[model samples]
Target: MMPKITTNRRKWKADLMNRVQTVDDNDRPATDYTFKRVTYFKPLGVTAQEKALSVQEKAEVVKRINIVMDHTINTKDFGIRIGEQLYNIERIWTDDEKREMELSLSYVD
Candidate 1:
Protein backbone atom coordinates (compact mmCIF):
# COMPACT_ATOMS: atom_id res chain seq x y z
CA MET A 1 0.00 0.00 0.00
CA MET A 2 1.31 3.49 -0.84
CA PRO A 3 1.65 5.67 2.24
CA LYS A 4 -0.16 9.00 2.11
CA ILE A 5 2.01 12.11 2.01
CA THR A 6 1.00 15.25 3.90
CA THR A 7 1.98 18.05 1.51
CA ASN A 8 2.31 21.78 2.24
CA ARG A 9 4.22 22.98 -0.80
CA ARG A 10 3.56 25.49 -3.61
CA LYS A 11 0.52 24.99 -5.87
CA TRP A 12 2.47 23.29 -8.65
CA LYS A 13 3.87 20.57 -6.41
CA ALA A 14 2.11 17.34 -7.22
CA ASP A 15 2.14 15.38 -10.48
CA LEU A 16 -1.41 14.54 -11.57
CA MET A 17 -2.74 18.08 -11.19
CA ASN A 18 -3.62 19.64 -14.55
CA ARG A 19 -2.72 23.29 -13.77
CA VAL A 20 0.76 22.48 -12.57
CA GLN A 21 3.09 24.93 -14.37
CA THR A 22 5.92 22.56 -15.12
CA VAL A 23 6.11 18.76 -15.31
CA ASP A 24 9.00 16.36 -14.99
CA ASP A 25 9.36 12.79 -16.26
CA ASN A 26 7.55 11.49 -13.17
CA ASP A 27 4.78 14.09 -13.62
CA ARG A 28 5.66 16.02 -10.45
CA PRO A 29 6.53 19.73 -10.54
CA ALA A 30 10.14 20.65 -11.24
CA THR A 31 11.73 21.94 -8.08
CA ASP A 32 15.12 23.09 -6.83
CA TYR A 33 14.59 21.47 -3.44
CA THR A 34 13.29 18.26 -1.93
CA PHE A 35 11.20 18.17 1.24
CA LYS A 36 10.83 15.57 3.91
CA ARG A 37 9.34 15.40 7.37
CA VAL A 38 11.69 14.98 10.31
CA THR A 39 11.00 13.61 13.73
CA TYR A 40 12.58 14.20 17.10
CA PHE A 41 12.29 12.03 20.18
CA LYS A 42 13.00 12.29 23.87
CA PRO A 43 14.36 9.26 25.65
CA LEU A 44 13.12 8.09 29.02
CA GLY A 45 15.57 9.57 31.51
CA VAL A 46 16.85 8.10 34.74
CA THR A 47 14.14 8.20 37.37
CA ALA A 48 15.15 9.91 40.60
CA GLN A 49 13.36 7.41 42.83
CA GLU A 50 15.09 4.44 41.21
CA LYS A 51 18.54 5.38 42.47
CA ALA A 52 20.87 8.27 43.30
CA LEU A 53 24.31 8.42 41.62
CA SER A 54 27.42 8.45 43.81
CA VAL A 55 30.10 11.14 43.35
CA GLN A 56 32.33 8.49 41.79
CA GLU A 57 29.63 7.63 39.26
CA LYS A 58 29.26 11.31 38.27
CA ALA A 59 33.02 11.74 37.78
CA GLU A 60 33.10 8.58 35.67
CA VAL A 61 30.55 10.07 33.30
CA VAL A 62 32.55 13.27 32.86
CA LYS A 63 35.73 11.31 32.19
CA ARG A 64 34.00 9.16 29.59
CA ILE A 65 32.53 12.27 27.89
CA ASN A 66 35.91 13.97 27.53
CA ILE A 67 37.36 10.79 26.04
CA VAL A 68 34.53 10.74 23.47
CA MET A 69 34.96 14.40 22.54
CA ASP A 70 38.71 14.07 22.14
CA HIS A 71 38.15 11.23 19.66
CA THR A 72 35.41 13.01 17.68
CA ILE A 73 36.98 16.44 17.05
CA ASN A 74 39.43 16.92 14.24
CA THR A 75 42.44 18.94 15.43
CA LYS A 76 43.24 20.40 12.00
CA ASP A 77 40.41 21.89 9.95
CA PHE A 78 39.56 24.48 7.27
CA GLY A 79 36.32 25.97 6.08
CA ILE A 80 34.72 28.14 3.41
CA ARG A 81 32.42 31.19 3.67
CA ILE A 82 30.62 32.90 0.81
CA GLY A 83 29.81 36.57 1.32
CA GLU A 84 30.66 40.17 0.50
CA GLN A 85 33.08 40.86 3.34
CA LEU A 86 35.43 43.47 4.80
CA TYR A 87 38.48 42.89 6.92
CA ASN A 88 40.55 43.41 10.19
CA ILE A 89 39.57 42.73 13.82
CA GLU A 90 40.48 39.94 16.21
CA ARG A 91 39.21 37.83 19.10
CA ILE A 92 40.75 35.06 21.10
CA TRP A 93 39.48 31.76 22.39
CA THR A 94 41.62 29.32 24.39
CA ASP A 95 45.19 30.50 25.11
CA ASP A 96 46.28 28.97 21.78
CA GLU A 97 43.20 29.81 19.70
CA LYS A 98 42.86 33.13 17.87
CA ARG A 99 40.10 34.62 15.73
CA GLU A 100 41.52 37.46 13.64
CA MET A 101 38.49 38.64 11.70
CA GLU A 102 36.46 41.52 10.29
CA LEU A 103 33.52 42.17 8.04
CA SER A 104 31.64 45.23 6.66
CA LEU A 105 29.73 43.40 3.97
CA SER A 106 27.38 45.21 1.60
CA TYR A 107 25.08 44.14 -1.20
CA VAL A 108 24.12 45.79 -4.48
CA ASP A 109 20.79 47.58 -4.14
Candidate 2:
Protein backbone atom coordinates (compact mmCIF):
# COMPACT_ATOMS: atom_id res chain seq x y z
CA MET A 1 0.00 0.00 0.00
CA MET A 2 1.17 3.54 -0.66
CA PRO A 3 2.04 5.69 2.29
CA LYS A 4 -0.55 8.35 3.02
CA ILE A 5 0.42 11.96 2.99
CA THR A 6 0.18 13.36 6.49
CA THR A 7 1.69 16.78 6.43
CA ASN A 8 -0.25 19.66 4.90
CA ARG A 9 1.57 21.88 2.42
CA ARG A 10 0.25 25.32 3.27
CA LYS A 11 2.05 28.65 3.22
CA TRP A 12 -0.46 31.45 2.82
CA LYS A 13 -2.80 32.65 5.57
CA ALA A 14 -6.50 33.06 4.94
CA ASP A 15 -9.66 33.95 6.81
CA LEU A 16 -13.19 32.69 6.40
CA MET A 17 -15.94 35.32 6.46
CA ASN A 18 -19.58 34.78 7.29
CA ARG A 19 -22.47 37.13 6.67
CA VAL A 20 -24.19 38.62 9.68
CA GLN A 21 -26.97 41.13 10.10
CA THR A 22 -27.13 43.70 12.86
CA VAL A 23 -29.11 46.79 13.81
CA ASP A 24 -27.50 50.20 13.66
CA ASP A 25 -27.60 52.85 16.40
CA ASN A 26 -30.56 54.47 14.62
CA ASP A 27 -32.46 51.18 14.79
CA ARG A 28 -31.77 50.59 11.11
CA PRO A 29 -30.45 47.45 9.56
CA ALA A 30 -26.70 47.22 9.14
CA THR A 31 -24.47 44.74 7.37
CA ASP A 32 -21.05 45.90 8.51
CA TYR A 33 -20.53 43.25 11.10
CA THR A 34 -17.01 42.05 11.74
CA PHE A 35 -15.98 38.80 10.12
CA LYS A 36 -15.20 35.86 12.33
CA ARG A 37 -12.54 33.36 11.33
CA VAL A 38 -13.73 29.81 11.14
CA THR A 39 -10.44 28.03 10.64
CA TYR A 40 -6.87 28.56 9.49
CA PHE A 41 -6.36 28.49 5.76
CA LYS A 42 -4.12 25.94 4.13
CA PRO A 43 -1.84 26.14 1.06
CA LEU A 44 -3.00 28.78 -1.42
CA GLY A 45 -1.69 30.55 -4.50
CA VAL A 46 -2.87 32.83 -7.29
CA THR A 47 -3.37 30.95 -10.56
CA ALA A 48 -2.26 32.36 -13.89
CA GLN A 49 -4.99 33.47 -16.23
CA GLU A 50 -5.05 32.93 -19.98
CA LYS A 51 -6.84 36.15 -20.79
CA ALA A 52 -7.50 39.55 -19.26
CA LEU A 53 -10.68 41.54 -19.41
CA SER A 54 -10.70 45.08 -20.81
CA VAL A 55 -13.59 47.19 -19.58
CA GLN A 56 -14.24 50.44 -21.44
CA GLU A 57 -10.63 50.51 -22.73
CA LYS A 58 -9.43 49.92 -19.18
CA ALA A 59 -7.72 46.76 -18.04
CA GLU A 60 -9.10 44.81 -15.12
CA VAL A 61 -7.07 42.47 -13.05
CA VAL A 62 -8.60 39.03 -12.77
CA LYS A 63 -7.35 37.35 -9.67
CA ARG A 64 -8.01 33.67 -9.39
CA ILE A 65 -6.56 31.62 -6.57
CA ASN A 66 -6.31 27.94 -5.77
CA ILE A 67 -6.64 26.89 -2.16
CA VAL A 68 -5.91 23.50 -0.67
CA MET A 69 -7.54 22.91 2.67
CA ASP A 70 -9.12 20.40 4.96
CA HIS A 71 -12.03 18.41 3.59
CA THR A 72 -14.41 19.38 6.39
CA ILE A 73 -14.53 23.04 5.44
CA ASN A 74 -17.83 24.34 4.06
CA THR A 75 -16.92 27.16 1.67
CA LYS A 76 -20.47 27.80 0.48
CA ASP A 77 -21.53 29.52 3.67
CA PHE A 78 -18.68 32.02 3.75
CA GLY A 79 -16.18 33.99 1.76
CA ILE A 80 -12.37 34.03 1.96
CA ARG A 81 -10.00 36.89 2.82
CA ILE A 82 -6.34 36.91 1.89
CA GLY A 83 -3.96 39.85 2.14
CA GLU A 84 -6.72 42.41 2.66
CA GLN A 85 -8.51 41.19 -0.44
CA LEU A 86 -11.85 39.38 -0.39
CA TYR A 87 -12.54 36.39 -2.62
CA ASN A 88 -15.55 34.33 -3.49
CA ILE A 89 -15.48 30.57 -3.82
CA GLU A 90 -16.13 29.75 -7.42
CA ARG A 91 -15.61 26.00 -7.32
CA ILE A 92 -14.61 23.22 -4.96
CA TRP A 93 -12.95 19.96 -5.88
CA THR A 94 -11.81 17.11 -3.72
CA ASP A 95 -8.52 15.37 -4.20
CA ASP A 96 -8.30 11.73 -5.23
CA GLU A 97 -7.39 10.66 -1.72
CA LYS A 98 -10.27 12.65 -0.23
CA ARG A 99 -7.95 14.15 2.34
CA GLU A 100 -7.96 17.68 0.97
CA MET A 101 -10.13 19.99 -1.09
CA GLU A 102 -9.18 22.39 -3.84
CA LEU A 103 -11.01 25.70 -3.74
CA SER A 104 -11.18 27.88 -6.81
CA LEU A 105 -11.45 31.44 -5.53
CA SER A 106 -12.09 34.64 -7.43
CA TYR A 107 -11.19 38.10 -6.16
CA VAL A 108 -14.01 40.43 -5.26
CA ASP A 109 -13.70 43.91 -6.82
Q: Which candidate number would show the highest lDDT if scored against the true structure?
A: 2
Model 2 segments more than 4 A misplaced: 1-6, 21-34, 38-75, 96-98
Q: For each candidate, how many residue pairs have backbone atoms clashing (under 3 Å)?
A: 0, 0
Cα-based lDDT for every prediction: 0.21, 0.56
Judged by whole-model lDDT over C-alpha atoms, candidate 2 comes out at: 0.56
What's model 1's TM-score? 0.13
Quote each prediction's TM-score.
0.13, 0.51
Q: Best by TM-score, which number?
A: 2
Worst 10 residues of 1 by lDDT: 60-69
How high is the lDDT of residue 35 in model 1? 22
